[model samples]
Target: MGNYQIIATAAMGLEALVAKEVRSLGYECEVENGKVIYSGDESAIARSNLWLRTADRIKIKVGEFKAYTFDELFEKTKALPWEKFLPEDAEFPVIGKSVKSKLFSVSDCQAIVKKAVVERMKKYYKRNSWFEENGAFYRIEIALLKDVATITIDASGQGLHKRGYRIDQGEAPLKETLAAALVMLTNWKADSPFIDPFCGSGTIPIEAAMIGQNIAPGFNREFVSEGWNWISSKVWDDARMEAEDLAKYDQPIDITGTDIDHRMVKIAQENAIEAGFADILQFKQMQVRDISTSKEYGVIVGNPPYGERLGEKKAVEQMYKEMGQAFGKLETWSIYILTSNEEFEQFYGKPATKKRKLFNGFIRTDLYQYWGKKPPRQNEMMK
Candidate 1:
């Protein structure tokens, strides 16, 4: 239960958001490229795994040091307090990555690290023979940048993006983490109207619903560290109970997801139902040009087709033009779109008020934002 260094890994361009989320959980974090580092105890592990919306995984940073040779790697790795995290019979597998380091062979580095940890464990547990490796899973990773190696153990078994919803999805469905980032980047309030025109699997709308309801994204998912004996189960139990108490299930939200493909619309509905937002979100089958709304100061967010293929570029450009015309009528509504097209602003017929570079999986995309005027106050409306 002593303080341990914890890391929350994030995708590029999302480190700041992840750091903000970590801070919101009452932990001060230092943001770095692709990861955020912080210090906390055993309960911090459970709380972070259950609450961090933008992080890819939560890891316990065992050690970090400069090692250029295999001997240096082995000695430094063996000297670390592996016994603090791993126990006898624990299934500890070593994975590694090296970048511009003297130990360029990733496989060899992994082997050396694994051997070192096994030696250290043997000394700690006083075991003479080989380990049965038939206990709780501890996935250890060694990441070498330049000559410095950072060793960590994965607390989250699977990627945090798997929120336990969406048993089915269309081709190239947006990841739950990226979808949550898109919603967090917007100024949409829980009381305001929200829509996703390209809601392929209802990720954006469902993530929005969760954010509006203050629901923990990882509430329904299990973590690899949940079975570890050193960490008390009461920590996880308390975190889940706190999440349940904080959720605003009765909070009214006006959100909708629409897609041109009826099958996708059906899929979105099914996903929404799985996420427990069946009655709260409305899914419709409609094209971008057909979208119409009378509500003022609303928000429209979409991840439209990028038309990556050579043959489909023209058709996608036309679709963008039509979308511009259709969406232009709603002057009071803010809009956000994600696409990889370099000429999106030209095709959309208006330059974006702001744009940010982000990665959707491996594809680089831009989030084009168009801000809208705020709605008048109730007193002013009455006047």
Candidate 2:
């Protein structure tokens, strides 16, 4: 039940979304370049790991201080209360990264931090012999920016984006975190129709289904911190129970995913079934040109090929033109497209209502949004 400083790390350009998710989980946080800073008890650690859909991973901030030299780095790291987090048999591994700092050698920094922690642990636990290192893992990180060292311990073993659903994938698959973010950015309701026209391996549709049904992204996953000695097993159990209690399993959602490649469609179906949405999500092998629906006020989202490779721009742009023409008929349907093409609007034959810059794994892209007419309330419809 000890309180600690927590950090939920996010990918570039997604710090706000991660912060929003942290706030939704009842934690006050400050957004930084690529992480959200907050503080809470053991329950907060478990709960944040279970929630926070867009975060890369959850980390515990152990120490932060200035380090001008190797001795300064080692002494400062040794001075931190490492005994509070690591047990005598803790298998803690130090990973390091240096950016714009005097300690330019990452490997050197990692070695020094590891030695310092071992020294501190030896002093506290009265161990003359070397640590057997055969115990639960505690991955420690030493990140230096401008001579300031920030040390943290990873709580979420793997990244949170590893939702454990997509056993199969295509060549250029979208990350589950980014997929979830795309759905969150839209003005979509659970009851309305949702689609991903360029659904590669069915990531967007599966993510949308999870969000629509109010299911926690980590509902079906395990975290690293569950093995820690200090945190009670009941903390994780209670957090899981909360997730189960909050899920809207009975809520019906109209979600569809289609791709031009039949192989991709099959892969998408397999992934959707694996995600426990076998019956809820529909997948089809269809081209963007053939996409048409009579349903009004639905939402369309796509991460189409950006035509970054040589000699493919003309054909991709032609497809964009056809996609625009086909989608132009559904004036009531909002369209959200993610692409690196600067002239996406020009090719799509319509200006976006709003466009947002988003990074798709180092390839900068824009999320072009077209607002649809808001649907009337059920009571108004009855009237």
What TM-score do all the candidates reach, one by one?
0.98, 0.97
User: Stretches of candidate 1 above 4 Å error?
Assistant: 378-383
Error of 2 at 310 (Å): 2.0
**Clashing residue pairs, backbone N/CA/C < 3 A, model 2:** none
Scored by Cα lDDT, where does model 1 land?
A: 0.94
lDDT comparing candidate 2 with the true structure: 0.94
Give the Å shift of residue 140 in candidate 2: 0.4
lDDT of 2 at 175: 96
Write candidate 1's Cα lDDT for 32-91 as tens digits.
999999999998999999888899999999999999999999999999999999989799
